[model samples]
Target: MSKSYSHPYWLDVPALKGQAGQPPDGEICIIGSGLSGVSAAYWLLEKGFEDLILVDDQPEIAATFRNCGHILYGTVESMKALVALHGEEKAQKLWALSIDVCHEVRDTMQRLAIDAEYRQEGYLVMAIDAVEDREIKESIALLHKHGFDSAYVDQKELEKLGFRNVFGARFEPGSAQAHPTKFRNGLLQHCLKRGLKYYSGVSVKSVDEIQGKVRVQTERSEHWYEAAVIAANAYSPLLSRFFAEHHLVEPFRGQIICSEPLDEPIPVSIPHSFDHGYEYALRTADNRLMIGGWRNHTPHGEVGTYDIGVNPEVEQGLKDFVAKHYSFQKPLAWEHSWSGIMAASKTGFPFIGPTDSARIYTVAGYTGHGFSWAHGSAKILADVMNGDPIPPIVAEACNPRS
Candidate 1:
């Protein structure tokens, strides 16, 4: 079933429509009620900023709803690669930023008493080839030197854990996973309770500076706010030309499939991935298997497109991945399949500060690690908007103009 729009396997929960149904009439307008936007509103409210408005095209099913439920601790690249790309200090700060956000999410859910089905079961980064095997070992060594508790596993141990055709793996004990839509719903409800004015099905056409205020022009009408934050992720370019002109974010579509709950579970206990995150699979809480990210094998590489329609070739690649990696008790019956777009950052880190327009800001370009970045990045955005000082390292790494 190849449709133009995505149909994720997550539950279809109703959008959180706050006290008002009309567009925002507040001092601060958050354009895009995805995890990023909701997180921004939460942080802003925490910073004593009231009268905030959150709007979304379809808040009921934001793009994060379509992501795998993994709460990863870093970007798709290994820690070693990160250090090589941005010196040791910057890489260390970047890694700490990810860890902070991940823990904040867990703490927030716990404090709010929201059962998001979050589990700190950690993650396994398996190596599909010799090169990655070596990379994993090196990355683990670097992580340990930096006081992280990651460990490297040999192929024999991997076989014991039921993974096949892999040389070695890196196990990060601090990582975790969750129920995507469940977590989003809980967070949204928490924000609403904190005086966040949320409106659903309100898509913004453009965010422009008008009369010393930010003009959020929607399809139906225009609403003005003292300031605005563009947290739309992959869709940011569609709303503002600055992002496209600067080539800040690129949209890449990813496909995923879910299998019927198995009577006898596969030997794998936690979420795992390989090939620089081109393929990943995990057993859900309900005993079903969900896998995604075979876009690497797709004909067009799944880039520069918003359509999340499932590609048959990429779907077949995922099935083949399953057949090659594991030996199931019975033939798997895939019951659901879907896809979604991810925003890859050209600057290697998400833009999380003021843009060219003083009245407008941004926190987009998470580069497929939104769950790990949104909350913490939103904190930085809030600080910047509040005239507070942000860490110099963060200022340089996530600079919007950079």
Candidate 2:
């Protein structure tokens, strides 16, 4: 791939630019025009909040648009690890939330008539070693016990599926994947049609609660709104002293690479990950293989930075993994490589709902699962704002105040 396009293959399409509307007054201000921000605007509009403005610093690429586009549930961690981290009860609720979000996003895509190349073929998590094999078994068992659809695939089964892996795997049914940029573009067009005033190239500097409204300070000028939501994801802390002082969210950079179409494709019918979710690869609908993840190999260097530049060492690590794991009929070279900044919340979950100020709210820090969390978080934001009842897990685990 030429070095000209520094974005993932998903973002190779034409950019969707929005018109800059009149200055903000009583309209709600949403910082960041990514999935979370756009979804928030969508749900708010659905709930009768028509006066809204979505702004982004970079109109070319929203952080969420730079991901691998797999809308799988749960985090990078397995179900067993999730149970250990937050206990069985909360973990079950969290899993349920992810499943619901998956369905919600799919329904939204269908409802809006989007041609985003969506596939509900599920996801596979391969275990590269004996330890991971055992973890996969336990994770599948836990998922099954919680009424989730999951199964363990032994090495023989994996081999039949064209995997050269040494151990078993965990297969979770009902998950889906899509063209990220296409989905974003579709929803953005819907939002814009619903009277959403969008402004690009407007970098937000700070958000402050004024006497009766919220003031959003941008590089160009300051705009006041009746309310504001900080959906800036990895850039959240940079927009507020409170989020920075409280250490709410930290930035992490993840990289991805797309290879040229193979002469003969492997039976990678669905997306799969290995090495404890540090690495993942999937054969696109067009037969090109896209793989990413290696932050573990450069943990310190990958974290605490908002830079989206490709990391050469991590890139090489991915190339080596592909060479070692799969055998294709023809030699393949990478055609595209890019990186995106992700926000890891203090607790590995997202921060949604109201902030210290009632007039100000937030929805960020999905770790690396913002695609699955955005619509659900937006629904929760709308619910809270509409004075509707929310799931107990959301109040218990996703409360911004807590």
Candidate 3:
């Protein structure tokens, strides 16, 4: 809020950042000010597209990151699922995009001077039993087939590395973590410097194609644009009839817990997942363990709606998980807890192309991997919108209709 630059790079002279004024209709509008929305805006600007408006219902920017567990840049295992559904070739492109997104975020942090506690400590994916272990082994073989580098850590090696209760793990380099809220704020500030018109508390009612252009309707006003990017994640279907009946862009509850700092560090502080990604944990900068994603606890209760409220039944399961997995000198007290809604498409990959109308594009359904996919997805959206050539695999593997 202090300042993003000596002057707003694209704002009119003497017009400050966060100024309240509407641009002429029929330009470009990005709905949702979360990671994907902001990333798309930045990429579009880099490609010389101007007159953009960023709309969100929250009063502040990057509201989603503030409520997230943590940010990690690993997608190797997540990609395996894609390969099964879409085959090897297209999945490879999506995997490349995920890794490329990680590199792009790292470089952007350094270039923009973002203070997000960025770390590239790598990722260790732990399996619960033989079933998951076999899956992990096959994933490694598949990664090898696809020319991606990863190493398997046996039980002994895992114990040596300070992990427990797993047959094996897949250690992937280039996996990174960061303070999510700071990273989002930093990106928002950087985009502001380049003249991003961000409006908060603007609830969008619908997005429809009017006369071959995208028209956005909100509670306060109406506007049109050459294109509209739906990066709202779970809220996409709610805002537009285009996605309502698709039934794939589903909203589910994702909650996280922030434990009080521990006196000593756990054997490993790198990010880890257990039980087929139903659970994930990472060490925080303050040395506390932040863990979440136990929808398996109350599987039925986790789905439907965008309510950011915690489920008490699932909360109990997470507490038991903490006591079972790690040791502490004293009883650990939970410091904070919160939940957010996330979207997932039937494809497991995000929907990332123009909709029925070429001017209307869908960019949501990140399936809980938005942090890794948003930036690259935005670049792809930018490429497609700016008439630049895009990788064909993206069109095939990530097509919204697919």
Candidate 4:
């Protein structure tokens, strides 16, 4: 799939060579070349920020997204989970802003001509039991109360729609998914054309605010910039030792699997999730059934973003669920499995603004919705970096202090 999406293996893409006598110092340095960092770099370069340095631990760009199958905006249900903690007004605001983020991802891809196979096919969230069915009903009401579009699907209706004995479900109309590898790489190539310099395979040791500048020290070199954006997400806690005490971000691992391309593609590319988003699946552009998520089954053990191999139980559960759902008498014959660490926060939203040191900014802890929120969060953070006043909606939804 090289050159199929984002420089296939990052070949021909640019990288910063600190070992080759390149200066570590820059006016602006962005840490981590994942989706969040790349997205921020794209928006920042568009706003006239140049000579920027992008660094990552991986050997290539969009490595994380490469494993992801879909990017549907599906966090409204999570907002409902947080309503008890954040209150109704705040929940509605968060819900609305999240929906906007979905639009943001689509609009940005279109504007940048990022060919990530962007498709607006919507998503299907199902509930298999009484408790989850109740949750779906409440979620629909909440979304409708806020004037968003969502429709409920009952057991009989779901059966007719190609499921057996489904309890209930909801459809999020404006949702969409993309070929993640292509999206991130496409964005990276576009940003490179606009003068974004990225360095890969550089392990960042620490980040600190010294005297007046933010210093980022990697295993091979150290650099100081006017300011820095810690876009590492889950990896932030490990890299930015100074901010770990604030306990701002916690890393969580998300594992995924791929099944053989279906002889016939599903009628539509509607992504699926249920059990409070503890499970999810989607068909890839190549018509493969890719699905994962069930960390709740191994809740305590699944924490920490380190490179822990896939849990056998969790992986097996994913295969079994897919088999049962699609009515495969035997297993679906798993094609591939993999995992990566992602950031989670006390709040479901990202910590998208300034850190304790106003000069040191960050955008992490997107939970598992990084794809849904990363671009818009990056744009908001970029707007702030350029000294533009933070818009009320952004401030309301992404205030780090909150």
Per-candidate TM equals 0.95, 0.96, 0.89, 0.90
Reference-based TM-score, model 3: 0.89
Candidate 1's residue-wise lDDT over 97-140, tens digit each?
88888998898888888787788888989899999888888888
Candidate 4 clashing pairs?
16-198, 16-199
lDDT tens digits by residue: candidate 2, 1-402: 677446678767765876664356657998888888889999999999978988888865567777888888777678999999889999998988888888888999989998989999988888899999999899988998999888888889887777785598888778788887888889999988889888877878999998987999887788989899888888889998768877889998889988877778666778888988888777787888888998898859499987888889999898888777776656677889999888888777788877888888888888877887887788788877778765678767765453
Best by TM-score: 2
Error of 3 at 180 (Å): 1.8
Task: Using lDDT as the measure, name the better of candidate 1 and candidate 2.
Answer: 2
Pairs that collide, model 2: none
Off by over 4 Å in 3: 1-26, 59-63, 66-82, 160-162, 299-301, 400-402
lDDT at position 88, candidate 2: 97
Better TM-score candidate (1, 4): 1
lDDT of each: 0.81, 0.83, 0.72, 0.72
Compose the digit string of candidate 4's lDDT tens values, residues 1-402. 122322222222343332233336878888877778888998888788888888777634233553454566546345467576567777777777777877888888889887877888888888868988887788788778877789987887766655654588888888888866667778888888787777667788888889999888877678889888888887788888645877877777777777656675443467877677777877777787777787778858488657646667877887767656664433454566766677677666787777777677887777777786888889888988889777775566555553
Write candidate 3's Cα lDDT for 1-402 as tens digits: 123211111111121124344444748888887778888888899899888888777633233553333345445245466677668887767677778877877887898898878888888778879988888888888878988878888988876765556688888776888766566678878788788788766788999998877889988788889889988888888897878867758888877776667787765778887877777888887787777778866748588866666677776788788776665556677766656777777766678777778888767787776776776688788888889665676666566462
- Identify the runs in model 4 with alpha carbons over 4 angstroms from their true place: 1-23, 59-63, 74-79, 264-268, 299-301, 329-331, 392-397, 400-402
Which is the better candidate, 1 or 2, if ranked by TM-score?
Answer: 2
Error of 4 at 376 (Å): 0.8
